[model samples]
Target chain A: MISRRIGAAAAVTALLFASACGGGYDAAGSANATTKVSVTTFGCEIWNTWAISKGVYVKHRLDVELVRSGGGSAAVAAVLSGAADFGYVNGYTAINAYNTGFPIQMVSGANVNALPPAKPAQGVFVGKDSPITSPADLAGKKIAVNEINGINQIVTASWLKANGVEPESVSFVALPFAEQIPAVLSGRVDAAQLGYSLLGNNNDGVRSLADPFASSNKVYIATYVAAKSFVAKGDAAKRFHEAMTETAQQLNDPANKDESFRLLSECQKVPAETLAAQPQNAIEAAVDLAALDRMAQQMVDLKMMQKKPDLEPFVTDFARS
Target chain B: MSDHGAKRSSLAASAQAMGRGVQSLWLLAALLVVWEIAARLAGSLFVPPVSQIFVAFVDTWLSGSPSSLFLSDQFRVDVLPSLARLGLGYGAAAAIGISAGILIGVWRPAGAFFNPLIRLGMSVPVTALLPIAIVLFGITSGMNVFLIALGCLWPILINTYDGVRGLDRTVVTAARSMRLTRRRYFLQVLLPGASPAIFVGMRISIGIALVLMVISELYAATAGLGFYIVSQQRLFRFPELWAAIVLLALLGILFNAIFAVVERVLLRWHRNVRPEGAEGH
Candidate 1:
């Protein structure tokens, strides 16, 4: 009995090893012409998934890989390390990397806040019965932000300061966007800064104190960035640019909302209902360079950056064209 | 002659200790030199010099006065909470693991029931459990502690069980011939026999505990050293990121050193009775 069991186990293990070995090789003579592009994988880095699902990448003849990154920093790091061809980054990160001479450039816009009238894509969400209603009430309250010095923290601080509340009075909690809902629900934090990408139920005993862009004028939040060397002078870069711009138009089009949402759900694993309730970002191809410049200056003013980074070289102005 | 022999041996031991210390220091110095040279050669912003990391560490952690606990706001906010969670989580795991190990190791029924479950639990990757842990425990220090304790429990438990099960025949006979009560047997013979293995398990758990500490913080933490590391990396503060990593490494070393000292003190008899190089042991 023992011998038979061992024999069967050996056979199974050998088969597994053989299959794994076979999976790694491709025939040399096989005519594989697709340009393999690697992009960051985030619910917010929606373009690659949307493009691939809707055959946009196929249309452009690019084999895009959605590389998993923890956040903007990791994504930028991936691009810089040659692990990714293109990666998602925020305005502050792009500006910071540019200043640090990381050879990364804003290839195209990834996401922006909902154009002023509709509530901003992010907000400070407090419990339904929590006493912290206005931003002024946030004084001496614990608010959760995704990263300590990232956009959420800056926005929360700005919101508090704007409302005549001392920024230092509010303690910022560093929680992932997924956990923010639970943190708020469990009362671990007084409020959570819910970014646009984080999927959460609307009726989960949470209400927004204020929409970020409701008061602020700027809208651009994230950018699709890549190393300048990779995109500076190549037909690949041009194809990527056109594919992204067209995909963005299609995603943003009201007629394609259902299809876009479907692709988003399939890719991000977010339910359509939850996504429907969440504040959608204004996805566009052309980055608003002025907004990005203003944000870079804001970081400098906040002492998040030592000095205002020169944004001219970072913005690839003619990439989309 | 015996007195002279003892004194000479003591002197030799002291010299050996000093030589070992110098060897470790030399290795560390060599590593730092290599790191400095590599950073200069690469000229990449990502790979800052070791000196810069040390400077960042001192600036971030060692700037405060002694009266104010000699820890910077960043250290007080981040590292302190992380250490506290690690200590608490490991403490729980140790207490439960030792007891559970004894129970399953001694009693055949408990071992039969729980061995499979323990095997299955250990096989599951921790990343898969993150969301479940968040949902079940909520995103608080409780959740962090629970995750760390869970990940750490297995090695300690399994090692202790093996230690008890593998007790020497002569030792068991001696323990029985002494006519010891159940409590006395457990307190004296069983525990002493298992001390070395328990320590080995504990050493393994400590590493796992540190990893889980960082991972738990990544999910949702207001203030943790791991979070600070991620935050710095995201913000393009490479020197500060390296500083946080160094802090984590120091914490690991500090915890292990403490454990080693405690193990040596507790298991002195085991070492004396059966040294590692001895044939039987």
Candidate 2:
């Protein structure tokens, strides 16, 4: 009887204790600021991080708070839900959001996929000894994608379609960028959609099954976004907007190249040596109008977009920033 | 006692029941009120009022034809898959956890062998196991189920082990004296005796199962609640995101209520024998 009483009391206490606890982010070693503008972020994509560490946001009179998001979709959600002031996403996500009436306008460019056609930014890789040699071979085999319906899926699908196969013929599993290489090497996933970070970080001798850029010939896949309402906050919006533009400018400036790569190297966990050798260099901040147009048109063709989005309302005229 | 005394006693019991009801719901109600008032005061587009969330819930999930099983097309494709994965994963975890737990608890050698492995498994967070599960099972529904089941297995196993290992020496001797067969002793005495602890583990595992379900679906999901939530968030569908969250919370509450009712039915004997004023409910 006494044991039962104790057990009941313990259970009640546990429940009460749990219920009383509130969820929060215990951010470490961050600057204490008067006002903090939170932006959703991923592990990599360090332009904004570069700007922040360089005191670029502080220069623009804003203290940027990096809120780690799950992925592109989660980032947008955080922005939409008022949990974040800005979100980083791909072009399709921005276009798709605009079309769906949950409008998010671009604040800055994150990175474009398949940039500098000479080297490109992403590839579909197989194990060094895998029999898979091309897109056709990927049929009936699982391919790890960062997101199922995101840019990687669209690019991979376009490549397969161009190679005389249906996109649905290949299975796309959601694997994080970091895990894609290991997953492919283990033979659980036959191929992985690998970005520059994953490629630079890969120690194992994994070979490209298909260069997605070579197969599909695409570019400009990513961007940063904010809710339309937030963007309409006039001067408050313009302050962050200028801050964002300035940050992107510095990120794109060749003068800051070494610092940028070091920051990216630290964030992406790739060697500084590897980053320096990559011909693609750091993601240029300029949003490519032609690339964005191609992406929107392609998404429409793939049925990934509801309608051809009016690109005017969705993007900032910051291409040359 | 006189008739007035009896009437007063009945009134006191009703008041106590009412107080319990109010006490249980107090925190929830307070939170909602705070949320609604703060949202209204702030007038932010991101934090929609709780009332708006409910309205969206109906619009998003309930505004559909029976062809889609009375769920919105998105819910049919997204929410149903998530529920299926959660159910299958949790079911497998409970079965394996109970059976394995009994093995570990009832047999000293099995306990000795599994203890270190269980401790190691428990020490590793469920999210950390996702990469391994993906590598082993690929990104199929099989991988999601594997993660959820593995994530839920530990608490159930540990609780059941404690219950079975702590089985009274007198109870074992009594069963032996009665010459009960192994199966009979297990079904009639062992399981019943261990059920309370098992139920506690089960209650805890349900929460774990739901968390893993979301995390697994967040990656490599073709259609699931997490996918819907993430997609909606990406698209800036604030109301819909909130709606999905509300639905998930309701589902959790409903599942726990169902478990409570089932536990009550199964453990009616335990409740009856439990001392008066010790109605742990």
Candidate 3:
């Protein structure tokens, strides 16, 4: 009798637990029953922060879940897998995905080119007292980059090539971003490639070498992309795009710039003043087909992409004013 | 047996062993050759050949500056932070998992209460919890440790529970007959018997802990192996990415070997009971 009672209780407990966890999706769906949009970490922390803070979803009776991914590549993968409705990817990653057969299209622009000319997110740095000034001087010097395949290295490679330096002329080392400044300060590396903010604060003994973006004549980087299937399936994607465009306008407004910077700082855990001082590297919210095509061409030239994709057909016209 | 028959049997056995060994070696050699050729054919972007990767690896690890390809202190700066996190997170998981597992196994009410929770936890993907963990702990070592623990806890807890519950009833009865208290019974009878299961759990959790450690680092980590790999991939440095992956695989093998040695040392008595050829050592 005791065994029977224990068995019955266990069964009941298991059933209850199963129902509770499974019911979570049902409840979430019913609550909004409206559009559900998925975004990545970069979008969540920066682009989506403005919308989330203003209760935009609540106002529209929509649901927006920020899905964190490894990076732009991972975000694209999520959308392709049907795990996310939308993803924010850099132009390079989006083009790479499209070439690889993922039917994704850029819907709207989140931010315009915020990076300074010749400098993308990363810039080569040398100790303020170091004699390594020109790319030629780096021939026998050690250079540090965040990763071998990161924007820092890509810009560094392009910078070296443009300066008539061989790709292997200087030794390249991979180090973490946080450690790059210290490494350069300690004279561990002759030069290091780092983000603007790291060099801005004088956190370590480093100064920017050359801005790669300045040489490239390219300004806009990163964009928000959505799967073609989602864009076609429902009006939910269109609504999400509208909300994003509205949020971008708010971020662009001069009156809200301070608040926008603060939110960005809070989300990124950086000092608001530091972020505000750096050149705004964000693009205005609008998909520029030509800019995207240029990015794709650059990727092809750099051998990151196998072929240049026709991006005009890939961009969704949901935001056509 | 006749001398001829014995000789034939010995020859067959030797041939079988030799065949297996040679096959394994050939498989390994083929994989390396294929990888090298494919990387070379893929050119600089999709894949960087093993030679280029080796050059990059040596350059990154040894050279302090652009010109020289020699070892430097800079490598430690990138490698140590990740190792430190792994150590702390894995250690915490091991301690908590064993303690909780034992408690639940020994106490009926505790087991009933925790069983459902553990099942739910194990089923929920660890990546899904990252956003919440980040919000609560922020982007620090604490967040990585929490995620690692979440991934490692289930296997350890479940294994420990099974280990304790499966303890020999005869041993418990004997301990009780001698008027052994609950504490004494657990330490003297239950723990020793449950050691094998606990070890199994630990082994499973260790692998999971490593994966979680990397995953957490890959996302928001300011430092670590996963951060190293992601940063490299982002920069489109295929060679450096490959090197980091190789290093991670080596680390995983090293951890597993260490755990196996520890398991063998602790469970020496069980060696006699284990069937022939079944003992890992």
Candidate 4:
């Protein structure tokens, strides 16, 4: 009985091994040759939309694999861990990672242009009916921001400082974008700093107290980054950059604005009408090297990063071509 | 019993009790001292001191708006949603697990048919199924619950099978000789014998359920404790993230303690029934 059981178990194990080997070989031939890039779910809209809308990169003989992650920081970690060949991260995250000794290079710029300019993606919002009207009123009041070292917090802090509000004068709270509206409506917080994608024109219950992008006009929002090790010497890396640059150009074309919005809406699972109506004024697709440098400097000023890291070493000049 | 025997037995029992008390107190003191030293050394980013975490906990509990405790509203939105999902998902897992476990344990044919599938299911990590779950359920509470249930179901089922299969053969034979009805056989023999294993399964499942709960929340949740931690970590609110971790750990310890208490109470009769000098008893 024991021998028979052992034989059965062996058969099961062998079957599993055989199937896995077969699958791996099939997948390797078709998918493994292409470099896989993991973009955060929040940033998926831009990358996926650009990939499908701009047929330039697809025409360049490059196969792109996109993986959805949670946030910019997570995308960097994914690349560092070898889970992804490239990652889509925010300027703040890229600066932080570079300062912390993570060998990463920004290949192309993803959201450098903030167009509508009136309201940026990151903004501090107060309830429409709230008594607190200005940054000074936020003193001793709870203000919701997404994360401590995030671009929103840095911008908010600088704005507060510029307005003569002490950093410690007001309490900062953290909440997700979707919850920010309800949190403010429910009076859980006096104000919330939310992403432009979420707090834009549609939200009626809150008023923009400050716009981060407008406050720091030169700050780059997010970027497409790759690990230095992967891009150091490989045709795969060059192909990736070529694809990314082409996609960026396509995303910026005025003629493709409607198509771009539709693709972004579909890929992000956001409502088409809502995305169409989203304020695209401040959204840019060019890789702004100067803006990136300023963002790095801001992180240094805030002490979130050790120093202002050299952007030249970390950014591949794909636009030069 | 002889007086001399009674005296010796009492002395041994008292010594053992004293030793247990001393050991427990020592353990508690060691843990506190270690926590204080570690908290002091690690600083705010890696580890918040226990004192500050305690204050954060109190603030979260007492504040009318828990979202006010952090720099973002994400924590406020995600915490309740995550907990609600956990409750629903865990409850479903428990119900299905116990019923299936009992059924398979009591019937040889049922156990034989389901054991292989149960083993296979347990080996596959639920995280790997995230994409499939998202595709099937979308990025909603349903996806979270499905993952949690899938993670928690196996341990309970396996424990139930082991509990029933290990029952004393003599007891089953005796019950059969007496011609006890199938219902009576289960109620009086199978279930009682399997109770200990069921509790074991429950204990294991609780932890697994919590992990699954966190993972599901972290990936796509708009709100929950997992989402709160991720968002905070992303934003570099290290103190808030640390506070959330502390709270989660406390919740886990609390859940385990509650389950243990329930087990002890339910198994009180079984405790005395064990043969004297038996290793387990």
Q: Best candidate, TM-score-wise?
A: 1
User: How well is each residue in B234-271 modelled by candidate 4, as lDDT tens digits?
Assistant: 75555667778877887799988999789888888877
**CAPRI quality level assigned to candidate 1 from its DockQ score:** acceptable
- Predicted complex 3: DockQ: 0.09
- Candidate 1, residues A54-113: lDDT per residue as tens digits? 889767767777788877778888887889877777667778778767888888876777
Best-first order by DockQ: 1, 2, 4, 3
Candidate 3 displacement at residue A239 in angstroms:
2.8
Misplaced by over 4 Å in model 2 are A1-88, A96-110, A113-117, A127-141, A158-170, A201-218, A222-273, A281-294, A313-321, B1-45, B49-84, B108-120, B165-183, B220-223
- lDDT on C-alpha atoms for all candidate structures: 0.78, 0.76, 0.72, 0.71
True-contact fraction per candidate equals 0.63, 0.49, 0.17, 0.17
Q: What lDDT tens digits, residue by residue, belong to model 2 across residues A1-321?
A: 999999999999888776554122112112332235787777665667677788877765566778898777677778878899888777777777666666677776756544444675567889889998877888888888877677788888888888887886777777777677877776778888866546645646687765675554445555678877777653334456666667667766778778888988887777777876665523555566666777778777776665676677677654334
* DockQ, all models: 0.36, 0.25, 0.09, 0.09
Number of the top-ranking candidate, with DockQ as the measure: 1
When summed lDDT is taken over every stretch of 10 residues in candidate 4 chain A, the lowest stretch is: A23-32
lDDT of 2 at A60: 57
Residue A122 local lDDT, model 1: 75
Per-residue lDDT of candidate 2, residues B144-218 (tens digit): 899989988899989999889878789989999999999999999899999989999999999888888888877
Docking class of predicted structure 3: incorrect
Which stretches of model 3 miss by more than 4 angstroms? A1-33, A55-61, A115-122, A140-142, A170-174, A203-205, A265-271, A319-321, B1-281
TM-score of 3: 0.53
Instruction: Name the runs in model 1 displaced over 4 angstroms.
Output: A1-38, A41-68, A140-148, A171-179, A186-188, A195-205, A234-279, A319-321, B1-19, B24-27, B66-70, B107-109, B124-127, B181-183, B279-281
